[model samples]
Target: MSYTPLLQQLIEALRCLPGVGPKSAQRMTFHLLERDPEGALRLAKALTEAVERVGRCDSCRTLSEAPLCPLCASQRRDRRLLCVVETPADVLAVEQSGAYAGLYFVLGGHLSPLDGIGPEEIGVDALLARAREGVEEVILATNPTVEGEATAHYIGELLREQGVGVSRIAHGVPLGGELEYVDGSTLTRALAGRKPI
Candidate 1:
């Protein structure tokens, strides 16, 4: 064996994190054991606490310790604008942009029929129920992947049927991205979504 059983187990556990391959996990394990054992203890403590205490917000379905997340409970946010996204991380991204001052509805994931994930799995009924509670516009902020697109389209149609306005967050070349470096699909999306000043 390359490592002691406990050491190998630590490396394997570390690999569970996104983008952390075997070599990276091994390095992290070594760093934790040799460089900063105290930090490792803190990380373990925090992860355990979060797993025990954190849960989905009753209102938006985003991860939260309380029944309603801070964003859903905020009185200052615009109630008429509801931004629907695929995950908790997406909610953080939109909040970090500071361009949106409205409430959010986190879908937890997009529809993927092959994986047995569908409208019910992602809480479409809950979203529709939320929309009917006074939201005027639902901005679909789902990722631009095939599954994300399908999920958004499905939800958009349902929202429209209920008389709620639906819009999609534009997807294309990123800010400061060069045209030559951009892919054809992204370029096409950019062109299609362009607005005249």
Candidate 2:
């Protein structure tokens, strides 16, 4: 038998999430309806509020409720250094590391020519403008994917012309990883990026 119209609609909507297939969507729908109607309502309200209030930060392109995100508004962060990343999620990951004290420029996404995403679409001009405003150094923290590397190289060249110091985040073996399990490329990068102890 088919689900009631409302239930079927809910199940279909759940499938819009990444990695959520038909079976998972159906299970989520049933679980929410049977055990957590209140939780479901809360989730709906949160989603609605986020969709209504959240938007890109004026300066950095990260998600924010106001013109500037909290990080952009902070005075304690170093203004002379900027870390360029692929997403708001990457910003969060860097923040969790507590190793970066500089400001950030979120690209929203990497360059994907096949998807029609280019420097303009990802706001590279905005980033360049921001860099021109006394940013002395730019750290490219884009992911290690091909698109990410291309985006970083493009930005690096742009910044180099402006006399801004540009650096890429070193990619290599993870801290708890064994060298035997590390891929050859990662091993090569680790060797190339070696530092004096």
Candidate 3:
């Protein structure tokens, strides 16, 4: 049996979300209609408001509700140290770790030539401009993927030409992971980045 036009529309709209297929979207539509219309309304309102108000930070390119995000506005963060990340989510992850106190420059995405993403698409020139304005060190916090590595290397070269120090975040076996279960590349990186006791 076919769903009503309105219900089908809702299901189709819900499927626009990442990882949500037809079954998941239909489930969500039914759940909202039958169990929680109020919650669904709230979700819709929040999504509309966020879409209207949220924009990229002028300096860092991270999502923000204002011209500058709270982190960018704060004086406590180290201006000399900048962390380059592939996404705003990465900035949040690094912040949650409590190990970094630097400002951030979100690339919005990594380098993926096959997918048509390039230095300009990721805002590398803007990042370089930011680096020129008194930034002493840049820590590349991009993912360990090939695209992320290429993005970091490209940015490292740009920063080097500008006389700024650049470093990549270490990639290795996870903490508490046994060596036997670790992948070859990760194990190799872990050994390469090993520090003196």
Taking the tens digit of each residue's C-alpha lDDT, what string does model 3 give over 142-171? Answer: 899988888889899989999999999888
Instruction: Please report, as a residue range, the 10-residue window in candidate 2 with the lowest summed lDDT.
Output: 185-194
TM-score for each of the candidates: 0.94, 0.96, 0.96
- Per-residue alpha-carbon lDDT of model 2 for 82-191, expressed as tens digits? 99999999999999999999999999899999999988998999999999989989999999988999999998999999889999998988999898999998899899
Instruction: Locate the minimum summed-lDDT window of 10 residues in model 1.
Output: 170-179
Ten contiguous residues minimizing lDDT sum, candidate 3 = 145-154
Q: Kindly report which residue stretches of model 3 are placed more than 4 angstroms away from their true locations once superposed.
A: none
Q: How many backbone clashes does candidate 3 have?
A: 0
> Which should have the higher TM-score, number 1 or number 3?
3
Model 1 stretches astray by more than 4 angstroms: none
| Candidate number with the higher lDDT (1 or 3) | 3
RMSD of 3: 1.1
Clash totals in order: 0, 0, 0
